[model samples]
Target chain A: MPFFEAVRLALAQIRVQKLKSFFTLLGVMIGVMFLIAVVSIVQGMGNYVEDAFAGKFLGVNTFNVRRFPDFNMGDVTEAEWRAWQRRPLVTVEDAMAIRDALPAGTRWAIEDARWLAAQSPYVASGPQALVQAVTPEYFAIKNLVVTQGRAFNEQEDRLGAPVVVIGTEVAEHFFPALDPIGKELRIGGLPFRVIGVLEKQGTVFGVPLDRQVLGPFHSALHRFTGARRGLYGVVVQAPSAEAMPEVQATVRELMRRRHKLRPAQDDDFVLESSESALTTWASIKRYLVLAGIFLPAIGLVVGAMVIMNIMLVAVAERTREIGIRKSLGARRRDIMAQFLVEASTLSTFGAAIGIGLGIGLSKLVAAVSPLPASVATWSIGVAVLLGAGVGIVAGIYPAGRASRLDPVVALRAD
Target chain B: MTADAHELAGLSTTGERQAVIGATGAAPGKDWVIVTRGIRRDYDMGGEVVHALRGVDLAVRRNEYVAIMGPSGSGKSTLMNIIGCLDTPTAGEYWLNGVLVSAMKDDELARVRNREIGFVFQTFNLLPRATALHNVELPLVYAGVPAAERKRRAIEALERVQLADRMDHRPNELSGGQRQRVAIARALINNPAILLADEPTGNLDSQTSEEIMRVFEGLANSGQTVIMVTHEPDIAAHARRVVVLRDGRISSDERRDAFVSKLAATI
Candidate 1:
């Protein structure tokens, strides 16, 4: 028989037994649903980390030079911690050497930060906020724009001015219903004049980014944060993406020479770019995506077995029908094609439902939670092919058995 | 049989049938629709060879309406299956439409059955889920007829059986007589060289049986060759010629009047 005719016949059979057909395809449907949902979530996390997390925590075309690695994913053992503590801190001379040796277009800043309780006259007691001491170029490199007042200039750093730039959350809490610029905010019994209110920076991974205060690295804020012992770190910005590796290489060489490290020893300090910062997350995401596929693959296997079982039953029930068709000039391949089409049609239908449900589930997850989801077109394509392939595999034995039946015996079946 | 009976009813004489059956390795003439020379079928019943058909010779001509009547285990069913191309004879030559078909393989026989034989079963073996139109269109579907033409031809065949108005109804919804007519329509859809029926009226009431008989009579009058297998003397009497099988061999071959008189005498 023609291919379309067999498919039509199979569809009619399924329609005649709607409830059975639904049960038959349930496994495939659920499998596909989870497949789509998990992949979507993993893909969403990947996008968010690449687009938002990196941009917020690490500036564009920027790398950080620190005494030890920041954003380490794994736990640091006791031995590793002692070794890191024994290394010399990033000092003012090292910062100046990196600044002078680097090309003119490169921007650099040294910053120190600590979370400290703050007090303002309007609010006698307030939340502990991140207080940072940074050079004047820090604002430009970090893209921190002041919506209200002006940022501190180069003269403030040279003169050791105590002017401060406060983030939106700090502004809201310390000076509620009042302009925060030109106000006094005291930290550790030292008062600093607020010169600017920085623009809002949204949270990353549920940690608020706007609860901050910035002052000149020359001010007393460094004493509170222990930067007086040694500077926290220097932030460097390359002019372009291509210049970042060269700049990092030059800094590594410069830092090693200053620290007097031998050729056999590792560098005492760490240089971290956004790419390096994301390496741990990339590996984690790969495992998540594989787990997403593996779990759903189990569901698909179960679904395939269900379909095979159902097809075998259908062949048995339709033996007489097979006989009738054989009597009407149907070849063995005709009967084989009929049952195969039925099995695949049933399976593919399950997969399509799965795709729809998977997308809905991902969308629901995105809506109710912070996770953002976008459906992968390639995943949908894979799901559809998988559904069809499962059906074809499941249909083989039953279809073969149906085709090999003797017409005389089959016609006599009840 | 005499020349007058051959001229009046288009029946082949015993001498003519013998001549066609004796041509062992050769194809029959164009006039012969079915010719079997010593066709035999055997069954292995747990290490015992039970012979179902013991060298039965039969010949049928085009446009001849004949009935083969016998009791249970008389090998009439075996003869019907061989003539219908549903089963090949285990021994001896069988020819249909001037072709030697006894040695043909499974798929080849399926093709021959598709093009040359149509079957009407006793139980009206229609696909219960399909509508009358779809049921009639089945043979043509396997014949690879395109959808539009298949539908058109199915409608025409249903119209021939006067069941076109009921084409959308399923087998369960149709009356016994109507279902049989639908089976008839399905059988004739391919315009096969021979219409083979197995107890075609067994499931119907007497009135419905008569209604089915009239349809078969009309088909035979239109020059369609038909072979009916039955054990009922009255049903066998409807055919132009009747052949009786006793102990796997032909006991009598006579015209319808002779068969009716013999049946009446026995009664």
Candidate 2:
């Protein structure tokens, strides 16, 4: 038969038996919808996570020198710490030396850490804002914004000035409905001036950045913290991604040289890059995408079963017609083509409906909630093709049966 | 253009007149339109072997009309099935239009049936929802005749069956006789070598049966070889030859000459 004629005949059958075709296509629709929806949500979440990390950290080729690893299985051995401890850890002199060593190439060399005498039950504003304490270079590193005032300066830190900068949330929490930039508060029973309020940066890993406070390194160091010799963490910045490894190596060597470590001793602090943050984010993204692919594939298998059953029914119903066509000089290939077309058309139509619904749902979620979502072109195309391919593969058995049917017996059937 | 039956006699009027007289089945292979020898068909009905045809031998010449008559269990339908090549005999050779149908595969047999044998079932077997024109056009459609030619040939066939005016009427909209005429039109559409009808008039009234028989008589007189199966002797009487089956075998064969002497006086 001609190609157009075969398609016309298949369409006629589907039109005549609309209910059967609808139900058959429904299976494929649900399957493809599951795939599109899962992929969209997971992709949105991955992008959101990236944005959150970028907002909270001053991470332009920045690396953190911290004490421990988040995913560490066990504590560092005493011997390991003792070996590391002998290497002089970061100090003010060491920070100044790194800055001097880099010359014109390096951007910022900042060091900071908080020493909490007690948790303070996480103090709040009258309307319940959140708070934390950070230092001067924290502004340049994470690209912090001062919604109102300015960050502390070298003059303030040199005199151990008691000026502090509060996060947007901290200002809202402790000094609601009032200007908080020039306010005063007592932490560890020492008075401090609130110089600048940080811009509103949302949560990262459920920890709100804007819900924190900031202060000069020396102000917190010599007075409230009362730390004669304790170090928190160090954050360093490089010119660009191309110079990150060189900068990290140079800084490590500079810290080691300044501390005057022995030949056999190791460095004391953990040096981590922004890649670690991205690595964690990437694993989560990969897992989400994997989940997205797997669920749809499972749904496709179920839809395939439904298509198989429906095609079997179609072959049974049209046995005499098949025989009639066969008797009129149609080949086995023609029989196969007719049935496969019928099945695949059913699935392709279903997939179109599913993709439409998935896109609409994504849009609805974006509109009604805080979730970020965008559907891609390839997702729609792939979903439709996958549905059609499944239908064709699933229809093979029934098409084969129809093609192999004994024409004599089929014509004899009432 | 307005030639009488005398001019259009003998299969084709001009092309092959000297050809068919040369040699035929009993002599060679040219005379016979169908040839069967020691044909046997056995059916396996749930492990029990049942013989539907037993060592049957027959030949049908071009331009001959034969009706097979027997009771229900006598296997006349089975015989017609074999003659139409919708089936194959288990134990003998059968040829239609000089092709050994029994040796051919299923798809090949169907092609032969499409090209040579036109089958008319007792129920008429019109696709219920299709119009008479489309139903008539089906065989030619399957034959891959282009659309315009198919429409023309189908219209000619419908005109031949006197259903030209009812071309667009579906089977359900037509009477029983009209429906049978459409089926006959479909069968004859391809202008095959033989028209096989299994009780063509079985579902019709006596008056309708006579009317259908007149159409069959006209078809045979036009040099289209026609074979029919009927239990009614009155139906069989219309044929120039009658083959009687009994207990899965041909019990008797009666010629038109013998039957003419027996029944012309009553007519």
Candidate 3:
């Protein structure tokens, strides 16, 4: 028989038994639905990290030199932690040497930061804010804009000035309803004049970015932050994206020489770039993708089994029809093709519905929560192929049985 | 072209048929539509062998309308299956249109059946869900005819049985006589070498049976070879020749007039 004839026959069968067909397709539908939804969410998170989270945490084209990795994804063993602890701290001298030896047009800064409570006469106590002692160039590297008062210059940093820049949220907490500029905000039992109020910065993944205070690296805030003993990071910004790798390499070599490391020894410090953070996210995304595939696999398996069972029942019910076709000169291959086509059509239809539902679910998730979602075109293609694949695998046994039936016997069946 | 009464004057004699049937291991001539030489079929029912056909020799020429009649278990159905290419004899030589079909495999037999035989059953065995036109187009479908050609030919076949107006009706929607006519149209759609009917009127009333018999008579008169299997003597009398089976063997083979006389005498 012709291929279209077989497909038509199968479609007619499905139309005649709508309820049964729907039930048979349910498993594949749910399986593919979850598959599409999970993949969309994961894909959305990937876009979010690249566009927002990475830039919010690490400036563009900037890499931080740190004593240890700050954004580790998986668990760190006790031995690994102790080893990281034994590594030499990134001190002010090391930051100064890197700033002096780096190529021209590179922006450099030393950041010594810690979370400390603050107090003001207006409010007895305020929230613990991220207090940092940083060089003047740190403002340019971090893209911080002062909306109110002026930022301190190189002279104030060299003079160990008591002036400080406060974030909008910090201003609201310590000097509520009053002008924060020139007010005294006491930190670690020392009063510091608020020189400026920074522009409002939003949150990233539910963590606030506006609860911060910045002071000169040579000021009295260094005593509270322990900047004399060690620094949190030596941040460097390349002139262009193309110059970043060379700058990092030069800084690595200079740091190696300063630490007196041998040629065979690995670098004890870490170069933390936005790309490095994304690499960690990539590993985590891989596991999410596996889980996405695995969960849907169970649904597809159950769907396949249901389809197989339904096909078997259809074969049994149509024994007399098979005999009639055989008597009309249909070969075994014709019979096989008919059943296989029917099974695949049914499954592919289910998968299409799943794709729609999954996309809808992801959209709903994006609307109701902070997560962002965009449908991956490749996932829709995979879902379609998987639906057809499940049907073919399930149809094989039943189609084979139908094709091999003895016509003489089948013709006699009810 | 159909042979007139004068051309079919003395049909093949018993000796000539015997000579053709005795030519074992040799293909039959093109003039013979079906020839069986000692064709035997057996059924092993839980290791107990029951012989359905035991060394039956028969020869049928082109454009002949023949009937095989017997009581239940007389092996008439078995011979019909073998002649229809639906089943192969366990041991013996069988030829249809110059081909030794008894030695053919399942797929080969299917092709042969598609090209050389059309079947009408007692139950009218029309596909219940398909329209009359689609049912008639089935044999042509398996024969690999294109869709437009199949539809044209199916409509033409339905017109021959005066069922063109009823072509869109399913089997259940049509009357008994109409359904049988649809079955007849389907059987003849591919223009096979032989039209084989098994108890073609067993499920119909006497009036309906006569109605179906007229249709078959018309087909046979048009130069078509037809073989009908039945247990009714009256039904067998409609054919030009009758072969009666008893205990897996041919009890009598005679002309229609002779068969009617014998049946009348026995009654």
Query: Which residue pairs clash within candidate 3?
Result: none
Q: Compare candidates 1 and 3 on lDDT and give the better one.
A: 3
Q: Model 3, B116: alpha-carbon shift in Å?
A: 1.6
TM-score of each: 0.93, 0.80, 0.89
Candidate 1, CAPRI quality class derived from DockQ: medium
How well is each residue in A208-267 modelled by candidate 3, as lDDT tens digits?
Answer: 678889999899898889876678999999998999999999999998998899999999
TM-score of 2: 0.80
Predicted structure with the largest TM-score when compared to the true one? 1
lDDT of 2 by residue, B177-215 (tens): 999999889888888899999899989999998999999
Better of 1 and 3 by TM-score: 1
Q: Which regions of candidate 3 deviate over 4 angstroms?
A: A112-133, A143-202, A210-230, A257-262, A368-371, B1-11
Model 3, residue A76: distance off in Å is 2.4
For each candidate, report its DockQ versus the true two-chain complex: 0.72, 0.43, 0.63
Task: Give me the runs in candidate 1 sitting further than 4 Å from their true place.
Answer: A8-16, A74-88, A122-128, A228-232, B45-48, B246-251
Q: Which pairs clash in the backbone of model 1?
A: none
**TM match of model 1 to true structure:** 0.93
